[model samples]
Target: MVSSSSVKIVSKCFVKPKTIPEESKQPYYLSPWDYAMISVQYIQKGLLFQKPLGSIDNLLEKLRESLAITLVHFYPLAGRLSSPEPQKPNSYSVFVDCNNSPGACFIHATTDLCVADIVGAKYVPLVVHSFFDHHKAVNHDGHTTSLLSVQVTELVDGIFIGLSMNHVMGDGTSFWKFFTAWSEIFQAQDSNKTNDLCLKNPPVLNRYIPQGYGPLFSLPFSHQDEFIRPFESPILKERMFCFSSETIKLLKAKTNQICGTTSISSFQSLTAVIWRCVTRARRLPYEQETSCRLAADNRARMYPPLHPEYFGNSISALRTAAKAGELLENDLGWAALKLHQAVAEHTSEKVIQMIDQWLKSPFIYHIDRLFEPLSVMMGSSPRFDKYGCEFGMGKALTLRSGYAHKFDGKVSGYPGREGKGSVDLEVCLVPEYMEALESDQEFMSLVSL
Candidate 1:
């Protein structure tokens, strides 16, 4: 096991854009959907890689240079959150101040641990959390904090590139787009190409404000301090369980057979299995209500359809709930149907209606909302191209998350390193539930070795 003590900080600094854009003088207003995440923690994720054969100093400088260029197109990320402004009596709103941007934070660290120390562990090692920066920071803290922080942790035989992005700035789609652009720029320079970095699909920086709303809609909180959600670290266990293509095929077949329907997707089927097993492990009362909250992209679901590369929070949380006993008692196909319906029903009209409702009465997601009783919250998607993040060394060995936004029932889904319809789930739960989950034969039988 790798001890947290084995990790040591080497250097830390802010890496600004190579040049400031004149348009950055104007503030980048956050949309209503962005404000919904003000109380939650930043997104903390990283990529593991085999050690690059070169001086660590050279590697760090190359990454810093490319990131600086990448920020020019995504300048809001380099900006700080503006101080809350009063929209009316006892209400406030915030925006990103791109003017005089302080830039993204970059840290270089070294660890005595190796790739095997992390990838081979039964439970994610505590030291893995050390690889990422901004551990306890919420998105509200972006005013005086770095909206983005990149940490490069040098391991004995590998490197881990960990990143923390303010949720107010973007969702996973936006985050990965920035990562991809940075990689593209770096690869161009590595091949001794011209300085003009040609991004395939540049980020769409314009904020989307709903019609007939906002001169700045009043936020729910009267003051900034109230936006900080109370979070006490719980003793938790996190394990990555892999589902191979064959396993997923079996799951889809089983679910379709039981539900007597062929419309349920592999993603729905796999998530259903997790929800059922976790609820069973919790051993809650038969009538207790349980929920599974999935983050759905609203870019394509919106009227006129937002650019696929929209660079801000354009996601809506879709929740499905059922009685604990009802969920476990029903066949897996029945549970999958609930999720499928949730996805199917979130059409353009519904997305707009929800946005309109939020404009009327804003509800900021807090720690309590995240850790709903007897529930699981699923974030991230297996569709995110985690393996494509390569900085000339090679493709990522694997993807992992840090300590932020993690609670008893938080689950992050990822595409398995192996291609061909495989899946991986990073499940976090309290010790008792984790033990029960790992021991549950019904759940473990389909796990890929």
Candidate 2:
């Protein structure tokens, strides 16, 4: 077992883009979507790979070089958050200060622990958190902290590449797009190809401002620390529950049969099962209400639809509620239908309406406000190409998240290692609740591993 003292930092440096663009000299405007996530913690995700044949120094050099090249296309990441109206004491507008911007923080660390110590653990080892550079930093910290940080941890027999991106910069889709592009650039160079690599669809850097909304929106907080602090999480246990393709298919079928409708999606059905099971394990009162919130990708739901490559936070939290008694009393299809309806109702018009509402009174979303004893908040998606990222060695062996945004009932979904309709749910809950969940036959029967 890897302990708190297992990992050691070897070296650290800042990596700037090889060629900074003239456009990068100006401030990068942030949209309302970006502003909403200012208080949230940075997204910490990492990929594990088998140790390739090369010295650690050589590998680090290539990663840094390729990363520098990658940043030219993602210049905003190389910038820092700053208030355009620093004179205003009551309020301030935040934007990416690309001019004289410091580069992304690059960290190199090592651990004697091997792959088995992590992937094979009953509960994910706490040492997994050390692989990331920014431990508990929120997005607003980007003002002084690096907007993006990359930590490369050399394990005994494997390598872990961890990335921390300011949540305000983008959502899961945007994050993966950058990762995939960086990998492509890295692979091209590793294969002795030309460095002038053209991405299939370069990111559209144009910031989105609703037609009536102004480019600059002032936030209520005068100081960054006042808006966000390092989240002090509760004592919790994390476990990855895997559901195979066959299990999900059966779940979908069961849901459709119970709902007397075939419209419930596999994702929705799976979510329903988790929500119901968690509620059951919590043993909440029959009269008490419980909610499940899913992070809905608004890119497709927006009017005329945003570009597939439209980077930045394009997500909305869709919350569905039902009495715990009713939820537990109801069948899987019943629960899934409630969730399905909430999602189906969020049409393109509704998305625009949400933006308009937020524009009227822009408020930062703090996860603390939404958390409840029995509530569940699901982020990330199984649709993301989690295993596709290959940083020269091979495809990622597994995907993991750091300590950021973790709380009881927080569930993050990832495409299972086996792929093809499989799903892995990283479920976090209070120790007692987790104990109940692990012992629940109904839930354990569905978990493949």
Candidate 3:
């Protein structure tokens, strides 16, 4: 946790759009994927920007203005959350009340910390949490809770924009769409062609029609307790492992040589390496069933291939399960092939079946249960381009999921700063396991300090 004294919260308030969105005065029901997280709170993320060229106050005012404008277009973000059966405590059929929200939470904060103090170093303290709303992480603030909470923190060297959006409303893809929209609005004020600017594809709020998925039954299991052991501990640690383009090339080549196939991608290769390292470091039993849950984006794979602007949760993960000895003793390509096949098998028909199965089984049966011991899950996508979200100030040097997304046996993947074939992984785990991974010679040799 970040010390309260480190970042001073100067002011906090809600900012609505310059004009209300007339089209969304009614309640809208979220899809099954979105509603599944109603009890989990928002998806928290942060961005790092180099110091802007103008006065801090002016820059903030511009941001506030742009945020209001952005909300007009992304009206769903301005909605409040509610369940269809308010009296039923376990009801997971939650909906977004678009007519009731005042606006999103916006905070103006200042800190003495600098970007250099946190960005590159392996052991920077909890600066990311200091920027967002910690109170709302596990509990709902009130009935009028803002779907989105954005905090702007200023330091001597740079600024951090932290976002906490209700996961029931959107996933990373939708969040980035709104973020990029806000950036574009902020930059259009100074751009040469302000009127000509337009988002590539406007957000489509209609729930994606499941072609083959049916006979849903998730509402009853929604009452089950959330599987939260992986997220809790006496001490939670976060670290970043950097893999350069050259290292990734080497890894891909190694995987190809080991698997006797030339089709492995950078993601497949790197995840395989980390999966093996984690399993070896944990020193689990030879027969222990270890699983690597790889996040698979379902946007381009939908039956109709929905547009990138299609909002809400469109993500599905693939599980690659194997014995500890298989991963620890076998060639890297063995794990790589498992991962590659798992991800490759998530076709349109497969996603529909997955949704169907999920609706019939326990809520969180597939994803959250996989968080049990001896399992690793990967998060976020490098394709979303977190670094490309450039406001009027500049492009983001780095962006992270922070503590909001951290858990033991979890890894977050991000594109390298240069956007080459490189990848950046943020790893979180128990202290002993981290110590074990730190000492693993093979893992150390492949990573850039």
Candidate 4:
């Protein structure tokens, strides 16, 4: 047996867990976004101090004891979707290491550590940094999706841990809940209160079941075919661009005036402009039905607050459409109205009914067909900036969404609260499309401002 005295002490943090009601158990398939969060975890290590150092193994033992319940919770599903079950608590595996690098002494650097790498020996998973490197090469044609894989290299000293999860499992909120619970367990152990870490009850398996289903919505078979097909040089290309808050406001005001509509939302106006500009740049046939799908948070819509501690997937998509020429030719107000109606229709009871119908269908055949042929996916989540990620080390210098290449292009929007009420947006498009947009003086003026 591993001795508690053998592990060393390190920094402590918290990870909360996601809890679902017992009744909703079977119909839930992990969302791709939820799987993305499975890979992130905390790193713990020791820094230089005047007092004597403790055992690293002992610290890990305490951590293990505190996290036993959570680990058990995740263990059963480890390989359910990916591989076979791991020999140990693969969900809670920890690593230790020692470091004596150049920034050692005056820097108050760490030497002993425990990381959260959970990938088993057989699966050669990529790291987050490496994933970013790969993202730089391919332009988003709006048809691709990307996953972030994080490996915690050091909990202390030379030891490192890796956590690999798919995006469909959960979003940032769900992930943080799990993270906080993990930290709380470590803290309880540090203070010799291991008993407090025990869970009151095991998680109840709550599966979702859609009522009366008859092929509810149109599935994207054509899109799936294209997804599996080798990447033919896309006829279109995507680019990344930014726009200032002031410019967006000015554009919105102009659009409101042109369409003579007082109820236009910022999202509708901005998206209308983007669609118009992009289509104008590419000079594509204007008769096609250009579509855009937005990711919507279902937290408020769900019955209970989906237990903030529940660390699994919890989001849905709302699709919007606009005729290419109509959007390009109409005034901003008219375009915004059209866009708003489309988005609103997507969130109605009928839409939810359709989603329910889709989920209740046979899993293997239904899910594969549902997500095919999505043209563009767009979303906005400002929680990253609002979350307390400070950890006593000043705010993060940068925060970015992980890459996605599954659609023709992806547009992620963020609240530009840092500077006025302008929205900060990130648009991922194929290189050729991006270039064409950039070269246009009118579009450049809007984005550059």
TM-score per candidate: 0.96, 0.97, 0.90, 0.54
lDDT of 4 by residue, 36-56 (tens): 222222111111112214654
- Please give, for residues 1-449, the per-residue lDDT of candidate 3 as tens digits: 44657889998888886778677787665566764554554677788889977688888887887888778788778777654543455544446677777788899899988888778667536666677764435323324578888899897799889888877677878888888788877787556444543565577877664545422223653432443222333355778788899999988998988888898888888999889999998999999999898887788997878776788888876887999987888888989999999888889898777767756663542234446666788887676767777886667877766456556787888888777877888888888999999999999998886
Backbone N/Cα/C clashes per model: 0, 0, 0, 91
Cα lDDT tens digits, model 1, 136-238, are: 8889889889999999999999999999999889998888888888888888878886388668889999888887776466676678776668465587999
TM-score of 4: 0.54
**What is the Cα-based lDDT of residue 124 in candidate 1?**
95
lDDT of prediction 1? 0.87
Q: Report the backbone clash tally of model 1.
A: 0
lDDT of each: 0.87, 0.88, 0.74, 0.41
lDDT, residue 175, model 3: 80
Model 4 shows how many backbone clashes?
Answer: 91
Which candidate tops TM-score?
A: 2
Candidate 1 residue pairs in clash (backbone atoms < 3 Å): none
What are the per-residue Cα lDDT tens digits for candidate 2 across 57-176?
999998999999889999999999987656667576898988766799999999999998888888888899899977888898899999999999999999999999999999888998
How much is the lDDT of residue 344 in candidate 3?
Answer: 80
* TM-score comparison, 3 vs 4, better candidate: 3
